[model samples]
Target: MRVPHIYQASSIALNTPVSLNDDAAGHIGRVLRMKVGEHVSIFNGEGGEYFSEIIEVTKKSVVVMPLRFDEHNVESELNIHLGQCVSRGDKMDFTIQKSVELGINEITPIFSQRCGVKLSGDRLEKKHQQWQKIAISAAEQSGRNYVPVVHPPVDLKQWLEQHTDEIKLTLHPRAEHSIKTITVPSAGVRFLVGPEGGFTDEEMAQTKQQEFVDIRLGPRVLRTETAALTVLSALQLQFGDLAN
Candidate 1:
């Protein structure tokens, strides 16, 4: 049977007892119904994972003893920086979750000209926290040692101003080339996708000024969420560990 892998923020050492936080404890006890003495893996989202066994089960906490540490190397060699235009409702959440599983190194929610959701201040903070949690869950489920970060939303123009990547491309329905046509970068790659209504003319101009090459998946025009997921998967298959 596959043991559960949980993400914890604290550092852990071998044979040392560690307590799960309220949320993680509830997940192990109430949700998964993991009892005392059950084996589980705990990771700090840094590098390796700990081989742990549940020692004490309580209402508010679950204590575990880490037995050993194993180095992990499941991340893709291709470092993809996803500039995703925030979509409405759970679409954005779905996109971030799947992207993490597909090996995206960084995700930045871009507020483009046609984005439906507008967030600021406290609302933005809440959304950022929620998205980060989703990415963490995906990393655990996908056997990733490192969790990809979900950056706070920024304007498309602002993102372009400071952007630097080995290869930069923006999705365009009318573009003449697919990912296969572009030369692979030496280190990392960057991708940009638009919202439901697509990027406005002015925003496209800005992307062009930043040297974001226009690329197409095919003749079909994909939705904001679909476009991001599809492009990321393609990159993984071509240059990431998925090719093996």
Candidate 2:
């Protein structure tokens, strides 16, 4: 059987006994019902991972000793930073999960004019926490040693104004360029996805002012969630690990 991969927030070193965090402990002891002497892999999102053996298990705790360390890295060579318009319901959650699995390095929740969901104060903080957890979970399941960072929600203007050497891009139905036609992003790529109703004309103009290249996936218009994933896949195939 495959040894389960767990995300432990604390540092891990060889021969050191490390206590799994509450979340991981619960999952291993309760969810998976794993017992002492079982083997598991643990990563701290700092880079690399540890091959560990469960040394103790209790009703509320789980401890492991690091047997070896593997400096495995599955991140894409072409760095990707996604600026995704926050979609309603589980759409945002789904996008966050799949994007991490696809090797995206960072994600920022964007609020556009057409964005229908409204969140602020405590609700916004909680939502951000939830999204970060989803990213971590996705990393664990996808065998990624580094967990992607999910930034707090930001307005369209705030996100657009940030300076980056990364090639900035946004999608449009009538864009003249596709992924294959655009110049390779030497530094990295920072792409934006619109909301359900899509970006307003004013918003598109704002992106243009910021020098974001407009690119289209195909002739047919895609839903916000679909567009984000589709563009990511195309990018990976074009310049990232998928091409290897």
Candidate 3:
């Protein structure tokens, strides 16, 4: 049987007993119904995982004893930072989840002119937390050692000004360049994807002015969510760790 993996925030050491937090405890005790002495893996989003076994289980808590540490990493060689305009409802959640599985190193949720979701104050914080959890779960399932970082949402212009990746591209239907035409960079790549309605002409001009190459996937027009996933998969197949 496949051993389960759980994400924890504390440092893991051999023979050390660690208590699972409320959420993790619930998952192990209630959801998975893991029993004492069962083997499991624990990671802290720090590029390594610990072999552990359940030591204590109760209604309120689950404790595990670490056995050994393993250097675990499934990250892509070509680091991809996705600047995605937040889509509405479950669309945004699905995008964030898949991006983590595809080995994206960083994700910045962008608020474009055409973005449908709007948040402020506590609502923004809640959304950020929710998306971050999705990223963590994705990492665990995909066997990735490190968890992808989901940045707080930012406006499109602000994100463009702050980002400094070696290679940057924005998806546009009428762009002159194709993904095949651009040369791969040595450092990393950042891809900008618009929301459902897509970027306006002015927004496209601004992105181009900031040195983001406009590229098209093909003749067909893809939805915002579709475009991001397609480009990520293509990049992974072409020049990322997925090709290994």
Better of 2 and 3 by TM-score: 2
User: lDDT per prediction?
Assistant: 0.89, 0.94, 0.89
Clashes of 2: 0
* Cand. 2 TM to true fold: 0.98
Task: Give the per-residue Cα lDDT of candidate 2 at 21.
Answer: 94
* lDDT, residue 36, candidate 2: 87
Among the numbered candidates, top TM-score falls to 2
149, model 1: CA deviation in Å?
0.5
Question: lDDT for model 1, on a 0 to 1 scale?
Answer: 0.89
lDDT of 1 at 4: 87
* Over 4 Å off, model 3: none
> Which ten contiguous residues of candidate 1 have the minimum total lDDT?
157-166
| lDDT digits (tens) for residues 1-244 of candidate 2 | 9888999998788999999999899999999999989999999988888999999999989999999999988888998999999999999999999999999999999999989999999999999999999999999999998899999999999999999999999988889988888876578899999999999999999999999999989899999889999989999998999887
- Regions more than 4 Å wrong, model 2: none
Which residue pairs of candidate 1 clash? Answer: none
Query: Which of the numbered candidates is closest to the native, going by highest lDDT?
Result: 2
Query: Model 3, 37-71: lDDT tens per residue?
Result: 89889998877899999999999999999998998
